[model samples]
Target: MSHKIIRSLLEGRLKAWAAARSPALRIAYQNVVFSPAASETYLRAFLLPAGTNSNDLAGAHRLYTGLFQITIVAPAGGGTGAAESLADELAALFPLYDRLTKTGFSVQVMTPVEPGPEQQGDTAFALPVSFQYRADTT
Candidate 1:
């Protein structure tokens, strides 16, 4: 499968997640999947308020909002496993994170990962995830 499919999936997933919590920003993530041939890669999702300066991306900021990063790697023939893990992580945060951030708050996930997919039953599976969030402050 091409990386574009995965990239689009990740962006849509992240946008839906941010919208649930921060309707004000109306986030639309930009995809940055690298090395299409690589089996594993990192995708970045950025959140910016609507009407944000197109020319001045990053603008000016003194505050150090914590960075949130989630990294998940699935073995060969396990793309579905990776996607599921990402879904769960966002699902857990979409509600509370939005409420907190709407009030001038900021948070970021530091490191997120999990073991390879674990089979529970003939038609079931479980994936692990590790995540971190820190409030942004200047």
Candidate 2:
């Protein structure tokens, strides 16, 4: 099977998660999933498909581990706190390295990485958090 389906599933879960956060956070990132055509003035949160690693977990079935990157881009001025808050939410949601059981995948690990600026300009500031998820490609 294609890993794209797995990535798609993970992205949907992340957006659902953003919506379920504290009221302020939920509203701050109301449009949690990225829309390429949206205006630049709004805070944008989205997932990037970083690819995956695979291995045979059992006979005839392979376990695929996906590498997903989450980026929270906020306007340059007060975006730092918003970015950090979202990062915290992601970190909390994954909790070290575990599965999303109900969602059908096991998270091998999720960590806040690229501690430096991914992109910076007059209107945006970004933070990237990386995650690994493993699932059977039966």
Candidate 3:
């Protein structure tokens, strides 16, 4: 896919998510790990509950309501593929994809790490995500 499309979406989503966090969340990179071209790469991101808000409920509680995990393959550029660029692209594309498909989905990316020695051709990435939803009780 075009890097521009990927970059815009990823940055947009990350920015939106950071704003939602209030204190503002910076991109965390330590959790990132690169696999041999044959294995999969993984990134994990967490969305925590906002500490305070304008509206208050008597019994309101801080709830960890979401999780987004994203795994993507490296582009063919060779030297240090575009992890950040790809992450940003995914961030933006996800919300739109969810909206279009009308599904409850999330995206997450782990921090970057060194590439391992076991890599082979066609590097792979796996982003395993889990989401929870409540049924309409009305």
| Candidate that scores best on lDDT | 2
In TM-score terms, which candidate is top? Answer: 2
lDDT-sorted candidate list, best first? 2, 1, 3
Clashing pairs for model 1 are: 21-98, 68-109, 69-109
lDDT (0 to 1) per candidate: 0.38, 0.55, 0.35
Give, for candidate 2, the lowest lDDT window spanning 10 residues: 36-45
C-alpha-based local distance difference test score of model 2? 0.55
Worst 10 residues of 1 by lDDT: 47-56
**What is the C-alpha local distance difference test score of candidate 3?**
0.35
**Collision count for each candidate, in order:** 3, 2, 24
RMSD in Å for all candidates: 14.9, 5.1, 14.4
lDDT digits (tens) for residues 61-102 of candidate 2: 665654666666666777477678767776776665554543
26-97 per-residue lDDT for model 1 (tens digits): 321345434322343233343322121223346543323223333333334544655574557655644333
Q: Which stretches of candidate 3 lie over 4 Å from their true place?
A: 1-64, 75-77, 95-138
What value does the lDDT take at residue 127 in candidate 3?
A: 30
Quote model 3's TM-score. 0.26
